[model samples]
Target: MGRRSDHSPDELRELLVLSGHALMGERGFAKFSAREAARRAGYSVGTIYNVFGGLDSYLIAINSRTFRQWGAWLEAALIDAPSDRAGRIEALVRAYFGFAQNNQNVWMAIYDHRIDRSIEIASEDDAAREGLTSIVDREVASTLGLNDNDARRLVRSLIATVHGHCALWLTGSYALLEEKDPAGQAVDRVLEILTHHLTPSES
Candidate 1:
């Protein structure tokens, strides 16, 4: 007879999610494996699908959880930061850098993940993906005195620039920046430009 399943579906699912998180946090998405996740969770490879449908589905769930956790970290970072707009934006940038450095594997997994075009992304998953951006969007709107659309556009631009710079740091392109600390310098320069451009001028 087959070995009996010891855990309920909910318990098993939770176990698999945690195991997947830890595994991906070490190996990153490129080398991730549902089989490895199941093995680590003390379940058979097939049992993972019995819970999550497939590897992609399982990863989507994992990525969603990761984003929510990251949002919490960013939120915590902002709490004691200065109340001024530039200071807050600077805090946000520094928080991103810290998160990326501290959780390199999981942080990269967020961007490294690629979903099938035919797959329907759950609304919660999309919202989770936007968690960090929503924080930036709010501050950008208030600081720049921008309307919703303009603030959103500016947020996207800022994310692209920061992400690109961070990517260079991750890829060891330090020489590309004319500074000792490429990532910090990039963030500082961008924040400086944003503050200068957005500050109200005296008549």
Candidate 2:
């Protein structure tokens, strides 16, 4: 960043998000600092507070960006996924594991950062964060031939199943369980859940 004055307001906001996102990637939530983010974006700490209102708001923006990036990564991973529904779900599960393994710091920060209760999440940022779930909800609806409400309900349950497996893998708890191929297990669990709703021919 040559001069903070060189960037317009929108540019500055983008820079702030990018800087904070990068910082979270490198140092994770515990070590994250708005001061460092401002320094990286070539601005004073006061400038960040003035622009964003507070650290919680700033963190939400950064984490929302992370969610978008994660969604992109998942989409890219599915590019060569098999044509069959089960295969595509398998690809999604594997990609979920792959992202967490590859981007440990930033991935964990998505869960680790907690906003102050008083700070309401901005609508745009909340929507960005929800995008990941939307993808899965759509897929679930298509897979089960269900309506939007049913799909949303089922997606939440299946996501919890997959997320648990991913969390176990991340925390090295898989070793304790003597498990192999946790991603495969996640795929299996997802399919099992769908099977409960499927007719024999559909299954």
Compute each candidate's TM-score over C-alphas: 0.86, 0.90
Mark the regions of model 2 whose C-alpha exceeds 4 Å error after superposition.
1-4, 145-147, 173-178
What lDDT score is found at residue 61 in candidate 1? 82
The residue pairs found clashing in candidate 2 are: none
Best by lDDT: 2
Question: What is candidate 2's lDDT per residue for 164-192, written digit by digit as tens?
Answer: 98887777774527777888889998888
Candidate 1 residue-wise lDDT, 17-80, digit = tens: 8999999998988898888888888778988777777878788888888888888888999997
Q: Which one is best on TM-score?
A: 2
RMSD of 1: 2.8
RMSD to the hidden true structure, all candidates: 2.8, 2.1
Give all candidates' CA lDDT scores.
0.78, 0.84
TM-score of 2: 0.90
